[model samples]
Target: MPRRPFSPARNVKTREASQALPPLPLQDASAAIAQSKYFLPGEDLDGLRRRLARTLAAVEAQPQRWEEAFYHALHYAFPGGRIMANAGAESFKANVSTINCTVSRTLDDSMAGIMEAAREAALTLKAGCGIGYDFTTLRPQGAHVAGAGATTSGPLPFMDVFDAICRTVSSAGGRRGAQMGCLEISHPDIESFVTAKREAGRLRAFNLSVLVTDAFVQAVLDDTDWPLVFPAFRHEIGAVPTIWRRWPARDALHTVNERGETCCRVYRTLRARALWDLIMRSTYAYSDPGFILIDACNRMNPLWFSEDIRATNPCGEQPLPPHGACLLGSVNLAAFVRKPFTAQAHFDFEHYAKVVRVFARLLDNVCEISGLPLPEQRAEIARKRRHGMGYFGLGSSLTMLGHVYGDTPSLAFTTAVTQTLALENWRAALAIAREKGPAPALREDIELTPRHLAQNPALARDGHKAGERLPARLLHARYAPHLQAIATLDAALIDDLAQVGARYTHATSIAPTGTMAASVGNNASNGIEPSFAHSYVRNMIVPGEKAKRAVRMESYELLAYRALVDANVDAERLPRAFAAAGEIAPQAHIAVQAAAQAWIDSSISKTINVPSDIGFDAFKDLYLHAVAQGLKGCTTFRFNPEVHQGVLVREADLAATTYEFQLADGSRVQLPGDALVEYEGGRYSAANLYDALKEGFYGKL
Candidate 1:
């Protein structure tokens, strides 16, 4: 296959169509943040856009024309912060990755393997990549370590080691190092992992999640007993009562089941509902340890035959296998609405599809310059060529069109948008594959086995026989379940994909673009979420600062409505369509996520916000509802001032809350959280200052 020549003739119409709707003007804070964070020395936002455009356009034959098109695309859809900061930044002498997410290689249950994993993680973080690791492979606490002739301290201690490493290593480009730590539902130490974060200041650098299985969910529903287990070693196989299950490791000694599960020995059994209550209680109190549907993620994985995913990146969006990596970008949905907030307001699907197509190619080019730190990580990305290109500002866009978030019309609109994005991205994939070849994973030879047929009976229904060798692309295009969603939309496209394949294995994942939205998106709703509040203060992590600085911000739609509809509109008195996160029903959020998940190849990073006073049983049921809705994961936040403060805080919530600030002499000064306090020639909000002192970052400033 030969690389395609760059041609901007087709995109001319797209450019002209979008010209009628120019990019939203950046706000004051947005401009300053963009300049200080993303802009290179002596460069403004426009110059930075041009630099990225030129760098990404290098993949095309006519770099100059494609560069211009890419520059225009940046106004509507931009890459993640790391990409914006590192792309074409070699001249600045920074050795950092443009990729955003990566997972550590499968860790072995030994000291040597654990140390090696830590070393690799340190390097990966230093190179500016957020990494995830599953800690279930290690033996349970009190388990004998024959090599050391003593009991092991278990995975929690190992997590502390990694947490220290993360705190010590300053990620490239001055970003705080990020990490994800996951444990299996059946791990013996699951209870400890669930409650670890509640101990304040422990594992602060990591986002924790539980890898939940379908069997576990069913057990909870059926009120059955759940066994906590670990893999049985060859020496202990006959000594212990063993059960067959699907495990992350592929060791030779483990006995395999018909469906490819491994033999494991049960350490103990607990009432399923009891454990569920424990998880739900902790999540309700502290909002830590989100849970991922492990089985669903693997079942829908495009490369199901090659990889097993046990963890996700820091945000729980991109669930990756060991050593896997992915870059991220999102289209600005707010930019596509024409005549916003008017009777004639509508999203331009035609223009939106064009941007998706162009963005598909742009993100693919990023793989060539990923600059991943570890060889295994680079090799994994090269084999799969995965990237997550989703959209931001869904809530804002829906509101702009006079539709409330999570209503029937809103769900319908979300489905249409997501379906269009999926279809167009696949169309671009086929074109790119024909031009520059499919991902290596797609071209590899794979043998269809009973395990494959068991995992997906569609393979057998499509006439794929067991023990037959076939191209991986055929398996993916013709038999993969996710692609079938669009089979009716364009049957010919699906047929063509069977023969032509795609440039990347996975294409779409929504991300929680907190900073990206605030800076570049003019404070649009964070990915697939309703506005947190109309007016709020965001605590931003400034480099070299002791504590996060508070910046007041407004939702993009609110700003647009005031400017385009009514300049004097009161923030408190809004139209019927304006629904904030706290105002929307929990079920509504699940409905919207379920609608979008149908078309998204990868998972979504969405948080359902519930009122702090919501009942305990109702909060616990949200997870069950999310699982029933077929979401890959579920995360929710109920603000607890005593536990922790979030990045986004509503003014009213702060005003209603109080913080007690104690001086060095033992006298305590109590003030409302929103009150400004002067300390050492600096002004800080009482809440922000309290958090800084409690979290131990105030001294650093």
Candidate 2:
């Protein structure tokens, strides 16, 4: 018999479900807040408020000028339209922030605090925020249960429940709930977890990733065996008492270890490389199940002394434990790319460095001011003092300088920009340290090592005499225990500086800036992605109101059907725009990602948008090509929208519930209310008053 698909409405819909799932109580909100203050000095309220006020004023005063400047700078930094937009009313509010949460055991437990969790998710989404979850603690497929007749389903089924919730909630109308889901490597269901999304239509509501541990990675590298374990639980299997085992414990006196309450009957251990190969294969085929370097995540964790980081947020940018929220802000690299005095001129590093410093300070301020959803999130954030400061518009930046994204010159420029950005971030971080004290993990002796002194003979001697030596100051300075204690400075940071010389702890990440970029009118490539196309049709939703009641209306019905049903209107006149990667050649797309990857210290989130004509073999080759180019990860989208049906609803259809409107007064408004409005003649109209309120309340200006 085929098993029925699980529904949240059944079994867990009533208040009984809430009662069944109890919240994991903690000390208090203050403990979490204090932890955030200790680790994340960046979350300083006074500093953040001051910076935000200044930034808001600057943007409001000359919105267009700043938008154009950001657009131009980002274009110059990444000519491929990778960094879509930088600063503007719309850009500032959207894609620049996030809300992260940690589920206890599973969504069932998280559901105990469901109202709070949903409230948090809704609030953040309403403010144009993205969300992430760590679902590692959920039990595997079949196990004994304390409730539910002493039988178990598992995390996957529970995740389906969460997906339904996301679909139904509809954050703030214009905001679609974007989420990340993660599971740990040690979980008994790790393989199933990694391959969950491989079936194409499964888990479409969220992005999936595996939290890879050092043990798991080392086993893969060393070609060794791996173990699978389950958490302890009380059960009686057919009148035989049983206990779920944690791990094999060694007995000191007997020189033997007993496997306590072994649940190995339902588990199997495999060669780590074999599992790794499976992961790579799935990634190659589906462009999903990307890896999180668990060791790397913990090694540089500022709060490692207190808590363990199990997973990252949906986009895989910020790693957090349970109930931890990370606030993110990105600098428009293109904004800093100035044209030289000559028509054919050189890149400007000096000015770029200064802007990066300012941007870093601004991002730090966001943490202090942003409202957190959970006490756990607030507490975890404070303990680590973590922030995601990234860049956008690399493709545009390259184009501004007359450089093609894939060429050697372009790659070199990317490398230079990445290194310079790192240097500037570190310098600023150091200054902040002087003022606020070093991030808990930062070492005392970290200092800037001049570039010329290390590479040039003349500069080396001159620098040494002037007490500004390069190699010793720059290279040796990096090895300092204090700096190393914070975050590992690796190839991503070293590559740019090796040619020159610069140093910084944490640098490089590409964020998904879709809505933000569009608001600024720069086009949407979402960070380091190549433009998906020159133009594509987008669907919008409008609200309608009659008296006090409201209804949701589809824009297509307003424009397309109105012409057919009422006065015939031509749909051809509707505006369309292209995404960089959407229409570009496959090789060019690869080159574009590579060029941007050259400068970024961390992994980039880019999907090579391929046409339907490309074969599986070609897809296979693209993966190899990306790996050869030193890319950490890559995703590809075939033009055949049908392929995405089971995995994701078309963005156009989803957009029907959300939309942006350019008001007659030159202000932008976002509509996400429950009321419906149809688009006619490219304008929104509602049947009555309720619809007006729905549209009016959620519209962004």
Candidate 3:
């Protein structure tokens, strides 16, 4: 097939229908083109896609065949927003990474070390990559700041510096910086960290998550008292406060700062359940801080022998070690579904697998092209060749297949689908290793010492195999039985892959998709999630563009239904088989994620949306349930106007309310929609205040 001509379509509307609704793809395009990412100078939509294809095509030894393969991949599913925006663009050779997420180098507790880490984070943010940090290394508030000759103000205060850096960088770039701030649950400042978002307009740039260890979970379940401890000081720095001891996340649980009897202090003891309640109550009120099973993250990490993961990306999907990067993309599942809403509504697993393979190769090329800002990041990525190749439109595909979002069949299907993806991705990675040679850091089998075998029995066999494959033994034991049970696709995929080695270490991760999902996804449900509402009025806040605009675009399932009707076939209607985000139960949401996570080597970026009426105890149990299922992490979103506001909201929800409560995302005006009473014995509304301000009635601060 010949390539399509580069033409930016304007289904946007003429002057006549200008007030009328625009198309979903157009909205997506508009958002993407807002920055020079997807569409560069003199480049139209088709041009952007072709350029992306051309760039990926250049990577092939035989360019023509792979070019066609890559172009086909784009037509079916979109690459991650970073790849779409950065890849094949004018900055194709620039020192900017196509990887979307990364973790900063560990911060030393000293003022100089902390500053240096912040500088590194700034350098990364400057290059447009979001970064995450583990703040638990810093001592508790009121604790000694070893060398600074000062009492500590806690990690929250230092976080302000990072928040500022993010704000400044975001303002400069016109696209705000993205960040993740994580603290261990055992940190003395855990209480303040959990409630940081409760303070309006605080840490506005960060996505907070509590790094929960298995011991913490056990303590919570047993209702036992837990200690909030920090390492004791080693010695003073110059004339500054004494610097305290620091422990790696892997060793933090076991190491005690026993430096003679003189250097002693009692750590605070708090009831585990009480602390758990605080996290639940705060999350219930504001969906700011999330929870990650840090122990689970480490235990499951294939690269655990080399690195320790302390923090995650802005989204919880990618948990990375210091200087780790997350390069990602997804296959569009909706495009591969055939004969919708019938017995023949089967997924094109063969085609999906091919696309996955193409993406695996494409991302390998990206590792070469990604001009990571820092040498450590570039070195880390070069060594590991880490990439994530998960898919989107899962909800749409399920709905189109005439399946419920969270039923047993759905769970089974979800598991099978992901299993196939992982298997295919694994196969592709191994093939790449065979053809293009393995990544530099692919572990060659080395003899393990006697002590090493005693410490980690799993590595008792000489050393890990050459190339970064998941090992034939692990595949046969862990994957084959489940995939064989699917009975849909051939079991040969796993059998064939188990025999080969891999190119990259980590392969699959489900991302939240952000604006790109709306842009290229035809507003498909994001990253293993159902649509937020059937068809809600989405208020798009385009930076520097006019605000308060509303667009009512149909959900992915709705579009699928419309396609079915257009094809002259009757399909199951909405609210019957199709369920949106708010409509689905929280547990159901969790089930879908847990099902999908079975094959995702990294993590799933999903939010279990809870209703305002949900009980506090039940909300707390949700995290425990997630642990029982061996999930990586869980985040929830609830409607609270007093807190930060959300971007997307349902149309019917507003009409069904009396007092309007805006979904808080930090940009909301601190005023009620209704003027129910007088303040200071005078009538007032937000409008009144605005009028007063306009008239210069109040004195300036």
Candidate 4:
């Protein structure tokens, strides 16, 4: 019987209009498919099917008890979104969504509508979605409160209330709710804002960052004083009129330090170089306290003509104004990698670009399809229609290219790749603009320019030259205008090559790639991390197992595979291989991240792998050097065998060790041996085989 080709109800265009664009040379389809087996989910239908089958098996094994477990598993698998077979799981995923809220307006302006907003947040959190808020609007401490009693409680007090709501509502079992809180440099309470998370265990549910403006940065660079002011507001309390308190002169010094309590310490002598140093120090010490460039963010803002942006989402991916939600997605770059050494081993850039374009549209739709927690959030989304499009498997892609990360060559390669990606993204965005109309905020006056226009007559003619007299016709076309069309890009993109600078508010972000990478069957160091060693054991908790059990290399037999791939060793049989930071030079790892960072508009989240033997001085030097190289930030983890826990042993250390295992035929197997292997340093190994033998034949004895 002939099979009917599967077709989607809507034929979304996945390619550019021009067929003249070159196609990726086709390699052996079978070989590509074979290699793709490891790639997983890169191809379309079959990959989705495989995912469904695995999910079903996991669910059917525990029918009633597996709902929560399955939800998280599926969420991790499809971070963007997914269609599920089980209505229950689908509902669960749908409920566990993302929401953005505005908190930058004065309490009277913001809170008047906040109770209802908080209620929305509470409901969303209760249902399992993460929330993000821009806290730059609340008046600084000592500022008068208008509505209630005309008294002052400040942003912190309000945040405390929000914290309580988040904690209470996001406590659903197996559902972890998260929050992102941000403040601006100009805020009167910048000192408290900078160190809000300094106390350990505080803000357990939230991530924090400071929104720095170009003016603030320039002030730091110029060693000039910066001001912290608050807008005056009127409110009635107990039938008495009250006015918001104003600081006569709030200097940068006051914002950083107050009366020697470490309230804030502003260094007037702080040069841009010095401030940059401080930021790097803080980031390296505590991963909190990231920077958000305000001027750049606003200059390119499409809504520059309308609204102002203050903070970003939790992961620092989207720089949204108050109540703005960004629909996010990433294309798996490794999926586009072709195999073999000939010209045929080329990447399918055109197809990948097409997919990205569709993904962009899908993300936009997500904004419309998703339910908002506040009216402000819904209103903002409709006004801006923002989305975050990024990439995953960057490290894997670099490895496949045979480029050692952290090296000069790798850095150069990364720059080229980023440029290519930026250009493609621009083309896609432009096409979308033509189809759906440019975002309401997009400036009609912006123009495209070339990098070396000054030296090139042709470019000059196209309005790309610097200091060149423009002809009447070119002037009329309004070509070669400022790139600061999008608010977010104005702060991030340093070099302006394409006139498409502010094409979209924010075009890049790096997320924690752990779960998504895992579902794709890749070692999970998504955008900015090195593979954390090839074979580290994962500790798992099983019923009746007094202690957590460890599972080592369960799939692909990594150790064996590594040995097989080693050119120096025997090719016929696999050997035992353990990959450490040293296996692939540390420099190479750094280079790979640097490469990816080149293309990213925002910073990358990466931890450099250092060998234990490296001295503390060396570590400090490494970090300092990274900062000098213009890298946004760097974290390092040195391997210490002294801290290593030996292999697994016994479950008796934990007390009890008995459990039941389900069989394929709707049956159960009872196990009565140690289920956990205990080792020093709080590590454990699974004694499943031993337990299964005692339990009976149905177990994997």
Predictions in order: lDDT: 0.86, 0.46, 0.69, 0.44
Residues 500-549 of candidate 4 have per-residue lDDT tens digits of 32235445555554434434434433545444444344333333333434
Q: Please report the candidate that would top lDDT against the real structure.
A: 1
lDDT of 3 at 430: 68
Model 1 clashing-pair count = 0
- Candidate 2 residue-wise lDDT, 266-329, digit = tens: 3557788777777766665566676666555554443333335665556766555555555454
The all-Cα superposition gives candidate 2 an RMSD in Å to the true structure of 17.7
Better of 1 and 2 by TM-score: 1
Candidate 2 lDDT for residue 477: 26
Best of the two (1, 4) by TM-score: 1
Which structure is stronger by lDDT: 2 or 3? 3
Rank all candidate structures by their lDDT, best first, as comma-separated numbers. Answer: 1, 3, 2, 4
Better of 3 and 4 by lDDT: 3
lDDT of 1 by residue, 406-508 (tens): 8899999999999998899899999999999999899888998888888888777878888999888887887666787778799899898889888998888
TM-score list, all predictions: 0.95, 0.57, 0.82, 0.58
In each prediction, how many residue pairs overlap at the backbone (N, C-alpha, C within less than 3 A)?
A: 0, 76, 16, 27
What does the lDDT come to for candidate 3?
0.69
